[model samples]
Target: MLEIKAVTKKFGNDIAVDHLNMVLEPGRVMGLIGQNGAGKTTTFRMILDFIQPTSGSILWNNQPIDLKAKQRIGFLPEERGLYQKITVEEQILYFAELHGMRRSDARQALMEWMKRLDVVGKVTDKVQKLSKGNAQKVQLIASVIFQPEFVILDEPFSGLDPVNMSIMMSEIQRLRDQGAMIIFSSHDMNNVSHISDDLTMLKKGKTVLQGGLKEIRERYGRTKLYIESPLTMSQLRSIPGVTQVTAQENGLLVELADENVGKVIFEKATANGYIPAFSQQPPTLDDIFRMEVAADV
Candidate 1:
């Protein structure tokens, strides 16, 4: 288990990370999310010992985190850097060796991970030779070549097309299934919702929300209704208890002040024409993020 208790980081007089606490267990993925300058990266640096926390403690399995702990952790930072001149195969081996894996073992793992991640280029291809998305894939391969017990990925889905994003998501899920405690930060709410077992949302260095996805959704209440109809936004907003209406690809997304208002919308929508689909669900992760974080601004 990985535990961070009341951890705080200060740079000069500025507190970059306020008192923050988190626990990550094996086979679980914790999604860290925040706007720019919210201190998500600072928290990851503290966990990796790249920087020291001014207060509180970080422990792995009841011991203070140190070099031994570092060996078991793999990190993919937001600013990706790879040796442009070296072959993808060589770069991965170098990192795996730095983590204490033998050359032969590292090479074997590299081959397997490369195949699993669906990296298209030959292993001999230099980093600069790959496309932007493929290069990102190679960077991801290097981080987990040895299959560390714990991995931290920052913005893993930053610049990928839908197909590439799907590939990366599958690989991350596979690692989690293999009992690697994973903590990752991403701006993409859809990816986070699909992959994370739990979530922590920070704003101005403080945690505003943290919990399992289902628990968080319950706390927000089910106030969103998806209606499949050709109704105009103005028409939808005319209904009683409808707080907001937005255009959607299929139809309209209606937000209600109370979930009980859903029945009223349904009656009106049906009255206009055939209702192909109607779903009353909790606010999406994106909705919750915008609502909570925007309030702080």
Candidate 2:
């Protein structure tokens, strides 16, 4: 339960976040997306009170976020900060204690996280000695081991391979199921789409789009479909109402100006005796994001 109302941040002459408003409900994940230097990190800092906003306000559970609020918030910054020489268990325990967890409880949490991440043997190893993926896993554990009520993860999937990414995603989903308010920021649109119930797209320090994922995609209009059939891309492109057709490994991707146009093409294909294997959908979050970002430029 986090709310930001008309929040703006200024760095001298530049406005990093301009009247940005967002809401993250309990038990839901919000994906905050933008290009590099699009004010994503600055917005996170303002929310965390690491940097005060120039205008407007940020509230956690309807109250202003103060030091007490900070205690209930967990942050994993884009630039991972951990002592290179510190052992994995030591670093996690230190952070857990910072959040007021008892040493014994912290130790137990550390072991549980290590096993979940499949790095139990690395508990005594120095962070610098761990591989990049392993170090990233350690950073993630440090942020959430204390079980804060609110979690802000910026690029949490940055360096991990697919398997490790799945592990981290499962953990984040578990936290959300337990009713933690989670806000995630990343360049990986697919992962964001998978985990987030809602999404906000930022460009030039302002929100360009914000809504539930499916609603946003439908709002953008259905412009493309993937169809597997006996027809070639050339034949599909020749059909009325079909603007473009490109071949894929298994089928053809057809782009139309409207949903009705796609329906017309399907009807035509049926009449031509071309029964399709399947039809692909249109306008994913990644598609909506690309369209919005490109329009801003």
Candidate 3:
């Protein structure tokens, strides 16, 4: 288990991270999300001991994490960290060796990881020769080459297409199933929603929301209605208790001031005689994100 107990980081008079507390156990995935300057990277740095925290403590298994424990952690920063001139196999082996693996074992692990991660091209090919997506895959392979017990991935899906995203997600799940504690940051709310067991949302270095995704949504309540029909946005907004209506592909996402207003919209939809679909559910993560961070804009 990893515990971040009231951890805070400061630069002179400016505070980058403010009293953030979190507990992550093995086999759990925690998603850290916020705007660009929300201190996600700073928190990761503190966890990795790249920079010391100005206050509080970071512990692994109830003890302060040290050099020996650092070997078990894997980090994939938001920026690409690779030698463009090196071959993909060499890069993976280099990272594995840094974690104390023997050359022969590292080479064997590289071959197996390449096959499992579905990395393209030959092992001898230079990192500079691969496409953007393939290069990202190689970087991901390096992060997990030694099978670290704790993994931190920042924007791991940056250059991935839908199919590649699916592949990366599968690999991350595999790591979690092996009892690794994973913490990742992503601007992609949909991907975060699908992957994270729980979420810790930050804004201006402060934790704005933190909890299991389902519980958070349930607590936020069912205030949004999804309707796929001929009814236009204007018509939906004109209904009593309906406060906002946003048009979406094949539907209008209608926001209600009162939950009971959903029934009114349902009746109106029935009268129009073209009800393809109707669902009243809690707001999505995307919706909650915008709502929580709207003041920052």
Candidate 4:
């Protein structure tokens, strides 16, 4: 649904996105992640045509992104855009109209979104009167009220409590199920891992890692293993294949030399009368990001 080919963008002498290439498939969520000032937002701007790239091209379904393509795109920028004094219903309807929806359709979409987000009781209330979480929900609804085919969400979970985060995640998943190609950008690795089918990790405007979550995790080798059993840390370390063992809040995080070693350690744990609660630890996106980016640095 989205393709970026060797796209490069510059601000005078400094490069923002350096020969970055990525693709997003339909009915999938791709998490675009990086450290601060890593060119994630700039890449989004280039894709939306808010800023032209210094070189390279961004394509949506084979053609360059243009006004017609923008109509099918919904963007919720890092800086949330909403009229503080406007009622939730009014603001959403206004955005819907901007997206070419008729007044009646806009109103209907606003009401349905309000109900879905559990903010129907505050539909008539001004955005400023709502809690931060509720206000964020309104901002999200505004972005997708037109049901755009592609949605770009930057830091959508910022400032949201766990409950609200969970609600927004469900809504995003629903959109994906409906075949909306979704690209989410966030620093939160846990959130990215939970929702993303594929992930791209950027560092200083460069692509450090990008692939299906499970595939990337496996590629990084066996970094840690979760173990819940009667075995002591000392006993685990004495095992031949075990390289490092650290206790987690719930269980042990055992590191191995390789996948083969991880298997050997697991067998040793079982042989030692240690009944594991769960015994697999694939490298997380955060783990891979740190390893790859730091190594490159």
Q: Candidate 4 lDDT, tens digit per residue, 1-297? A: 789999999999998889999999889999999998889999999999999999998999999988888988989999887898888888788888777778898888888888878873478898889887788888888899999999999888888899889997998899999999999899888999999999888888888888999898888776678888777899889887787889998778888777677666666667866484756666777777777767864
CA lDDT of each candidate? Answer: 0.89, 0.85, 0.89, 0.85
TM-score of each: 0.91, 0.95, 0.91, 0.92
lDDT per residue (tens digit) for residues 1-297 in model 3: 999999999999988999999999999999999989999999999998899999999999998888888888988988887899999888888888888778899898888877876778888999999987788888888888888999999888887888789988988889999999899998999999998998999898899999999998877778988899778888887788888888877888888878888887888789957688898999899989999999652
Give lDDT for model 3.
0.89
How much is the lDDT of residue 262 in candidate 1?
85
lDDT of 4: 0.85
Off by over 4 Å in 3: 228-235, 246-251, 267-275
lDDT for 50 in candidate 2 is: 84
The candidate maximizing TM-score is 2
Candidate 4 regions exceeding 4 Å error are 228-231, 239-241, 249-251, 272-274
| Residue pairs clashing, model 1 | none
- What tens digits encode model 1's per-residue C-alpha lDDT throughout 133-172? 8888888888888889999998888888898899889988
